[model samples]
Target: MAMPAAEIEALIRAALPDAEVEITDLAGDGDHYAARVVSESFRGKSLVQRHKLVYEALGGRMGGELHALQLKTEVPN
Candidate 1:
């Protein structure tokens, strides 16, 4: 099954309560998506680490129920 944008956002928010999450369905398929997450918690974290955090929020759905996610992570200014 494909993951919903709301589910994606909810997972991200659950991990980063202060994160500003924007999820887009890139291919009009529930499996493909793009997400931009901005959070103060990302401060001091490396790009790889930031991505890891987001992946962790997904709780291992990256390649199973969810696929092809173009993710962007940034710290709030």
Candidate 2:
């Protein structure tokens, strides 16, 4: 099963309402995606913690419905 980009964005937004999310379909396939998420919530958090927040938003779909995600997270300037 594959997840849509909009759904992924929606999920992240739902978790971090202030987030700025950009989703890209890496291989033009729904299974592979790249996401850039920026939010104040990521401020002061470690790299691993920032990623955990995004994964938590996805609700455990990372390896199931979502095959691969190249994720980047940052605190806004």
Candidate 3:
């Protein structure tokens, strides 16, 4: 089963309440997604750490329910 975009957004938001998350269906197949996440909490976090946060928010659904995710994270300037 593929993870819904809303679920993705909700999960991220649950973890980072001040995040601005945008999810795109890259292949229009619901399994592949591209997400741009902007959050104040990511301000001082390393790139790897930021990605880890997003992955953690997904709750281990990455290679199972969700096939591929092209993720980008940024902190507000």
Best of the candidates, TM-score: 2
Q: Over the stretch 1-69, how does candidate 2's per-residue lDDT look in tens digits?
A: 889999999999999999999999999879999999999999999999999999999999999999999
Which consecutive 10 residues in model 1 have the weakest lDDT in total?
Answer: 68-77
lDDT of 3 by residue, 1-76 (tens): 8888999999999999999999999988899999999999998899999999999999999999999999999999
Counting clashing residue pairs in each candidate, in order, gives 0, 0, 0
In candidate 3, position 46 carries an lDDT of 98
Error of 1 at 19 (Å): 0.2
Q: Candidate 2: misplaced stretches above 4 Å?
A: none
Candidate 1 lDDT over 1-77, as tens digits, reads 88999999999999999999999999998999999999999999999999999999999998999988898999887
Q: C-alpha displacement of 63 in model 3, angstroms? A: 0.2
**Whole-model lDDT values for every prediction:** 0.95, 0.97, 0.95
Summing lDDT over every window of 10 consecutive residues in candidate 2, give the lowest-scoring window: 25-34
Clashing pairs in 2: none
Model 2 lDDT, full chain set: 0.97
TM-score of 1: 0.97
Clashes of 2: 0
